[model samples]
Target: MFKDSKKKLSAPATDTLLANGTSFEGTIEAEANIRIDGHFQGDIRSTRTVVIGESAVVRSDIIARDVILAGKVFGSITTEGRLTITPTGELYGKVAVAALVISEGGVLDGTSQMIRTKDAEPSASTDDSDLETQSGTRKDRDTSQATLQSETG
Candidate 1:
């Protein structure tokens, strides 16, 4: 059936799990989602999502499509999709994400850069993305406004 085929295509094949009391140190590269409940110290690169459990502690750079943090993290994070920090989550490093959600009790102590992938990388010379054009024009207008204000004042 077409619905069955679509469901199969959308489902991920595998997911990695790091249970409580476990510890890992090194770079982790996976194509599936990784859920960490223990301690991890190193770089993590995944095309899928990375979920840090409530008891987990991660101290490394994380790059993934999506990231859900319910624990403590102390390094840079880059997500192409969305980054969700739960109420119990604590983040102490810079974040680069297209979208981010922070719960009421979550704590973030670093800078956040909202990255528009289409703006940052155009497909072709003729490809005109609205975000890119808007951002460019906004930058130009800001610069011109600043110059005019300074000159007049």
Candidate 2:
């Protein structure tokens, strides 16, 4: 009998919270989402979402897939997906984001750059002889490489 072809989906990402009045100073790296409601003075790196609460005060850089800010931040921020600044938020550093949203009353006192999404691959030309298909189009070599690796193993 043939095995099931579909891959199983993973569970949703979890969230970690830093409660109010808590103060921390160090680097934070996590796979789950994070919500901060206190004072932080270090860097934050996450593969999931990061949220800064209304009463939070941060003085460090943040890198995440998605970011939501509703507090006062005094450092730079980079997001792979979207960055949202709520009405009560105030950001005072540079930002590099794929997409950004700032609500009314939100303040941004620094520069920002819109970055391209990582999902878009480079276009391939058919005039090259490296990977010309029967239809005169270049095949995606990266996809074929991945498939071959998976089949061999």
Give the 10-residue window scoring lowest on summed lDDT in candidate 2: 6-15
lDDT of 2 by residue, 83-124 (tens): 888889899999999999898899999999999875654565
Worst 10 residues of 1 by lDDT: 5-14
Error of 1 at 56 (Å): 0.3
What stretches of model 1 exceed 4 Å from their correct place?
1-14, 119-153
Count clashing residue pairs in model 1.
Answer: 0
TM-score: model 1 vs. ground truth: 0.71
Report the Cα RMSD per candidate: 7.3, 15.3
Candidate 1 lDDT, tens digit per residue, 8-123? 11223338988899999999999989889999999999999898889999998999998888899999999999898888999999999999989789989999999987867765
Clashing pairs in 2: none
Q: In TM-score terms, which candidate is top?
A: 1
